[model samples]
Target: MPVTLRPLRVAAAQAESVAGDLDANVATAVHLVSAAADWGARVVVLPELFLTGYSPQAWLPELTTTPDDPRLEPLASAARERAVVVVAGAAVRRSGPDGSAQRFTLSLLVVDEAGEVTAPYDKQHLFDTERAFFAPGAQGASIVVDGWELGLGVCYDGCFPEHARAAAEDGARAYLCPSAYVAGSEHRRDLYYAARALDNGIYVVFAGLTGRCGGLDFSGGSAVYDPEGRALGRAGIISPAAVVADLDPVEVARVQAENPIARDRLGSLGGRSRVVVAGPRP
Candidate 1:
């Protein structure tokens, strides 16, 4: 006989954040986490810089969060209570290249089902404007949830094919992208997610921010793309919503077997990008 388990359901979420208001934003995040779990999702990903609302205000010293920051405790508790893994975004501090001062890194903090958080997975690729505000992370990262090895990346990180390819080379079955796209930039999200999924034969989940933040407006385009670059699920534009989908390991294996991209690839030519894995989630 064979052992059987529950289906692997995951969700991508978007919410309108209260700029620079940690209390309100954290509450909204917790609510969304609960909503995802209630929908039978075992893992959930939220938009980038959600805690500080992706505003210019993110550069402020008060907006930085650490893995164990008390402000995120409620969110960890929510994941623990719901028995789901929550990949959430925040502005976290990291030593500057000069090592003289601390700067921010757009990062994802993984909250395991036990309410413990793994160290932040900072964004590896920073957009043009972001390069001035944040220091790019040194490498890629992945986290395990209920035995699924999922890759991690922030907004612009997905734009680079090497980022996702490295994760696939490092054995990630799914890529969780927490992103934010301004009003007219929605098309970029679709193209990148689909490209990444097809290029690496891996599932891609996108969580985008919605509504106004600072002087800009964002259109939520949360979606999930299967290994063949097909849209498996999608959330409405510019409104708070969660895109939920059931990930099938068998389907992933089938795609990889048929495509052989991972096997025939010229030996991880994506250059020195190392992928760090977080673990076997309970």
Candidate 2:
């Protein structure tokens, strides 16, 4: 018998984070996750560093937490109660090589419906300003939910085609970018995200932080794109919002079969290339 592909309802949330407030931010994330679940979203993605405002300058150290921190339990509980996958951001602390001083990395925490949290997926690409505080992650990361492979990326990572390409090569049918882009940049970012989807033949979901944080206003253009690079759903750039869309794996398969960009690369290059690690995934 042939297999059937089910549609996966996914959501992207655009909201501001309170700087240096873990409890309040976690509460907000839980609320957003619950709201998405209410809307029948199987997977809800929040903005980058939503748990601790995207203030890399001052709040980086203040907001850093270990993966097993007790404060994160509320999010896990909410995921279990909603029976949905919750992806949120935070600063994760890890010891340096050979037990050196602790280092922080911008990361996403994936909480399953069973309340089990996966290891932190760090952001490999750092924006110019972010490098001063957080260390870059080591590799790319993806999670399989309901037999769908969903890849993860942070703000600036979405700007790099190689980042999404690496995930696509790793069998990701969709790429989720949790970002904190400032106001006035939404238009360019939207085009970039669409191109990423078109080039990879995979769904692209962008969740951006909105409102003001640390004296900077954010652009809230949260959106979901289909494999054809069409906007399935999108939120405005002015306020906190959520965009939900259904992703069908069958559509991805159909697009890949028709376009064949992912598979045609080697033959197009005359089979003279070898793959190399573009960057790190944590």
TM-score of each: 0.89, 0.90
Report the lDDT of model 2 for residue 122.
93
Q: How well does candidate 1 score on lDDT at residue 119? A: 57
**Model 2: pairs clashing at backbone N, Cα or C within 3 Å:** 138-280, 138-281, 139-280, 139-281, 140-281
Candidate 1 similarity to native, TM-score: 0.89
lDDT of 1: 0.85
Off by over 4 Å in 1: 1-7, 95-101, 267-282
User: For model 2, what is the alpha-carbon lDDT of residue 72?
Assistant: 87
Candidate 2 per-residue lDDT, tens place, 76-174, comes to: 899999999988888888886888798888899888999887655899988888888888999899998888889999988989999999999999999
Native RMSD of candidate 1 (Å) = 10.2
Candidate 1 residue-wise lDDT, 26-139, digit = tens: 899999999888899899899998887788765677777778678888998999899998888888876658978887788888888999986558898888777777788888
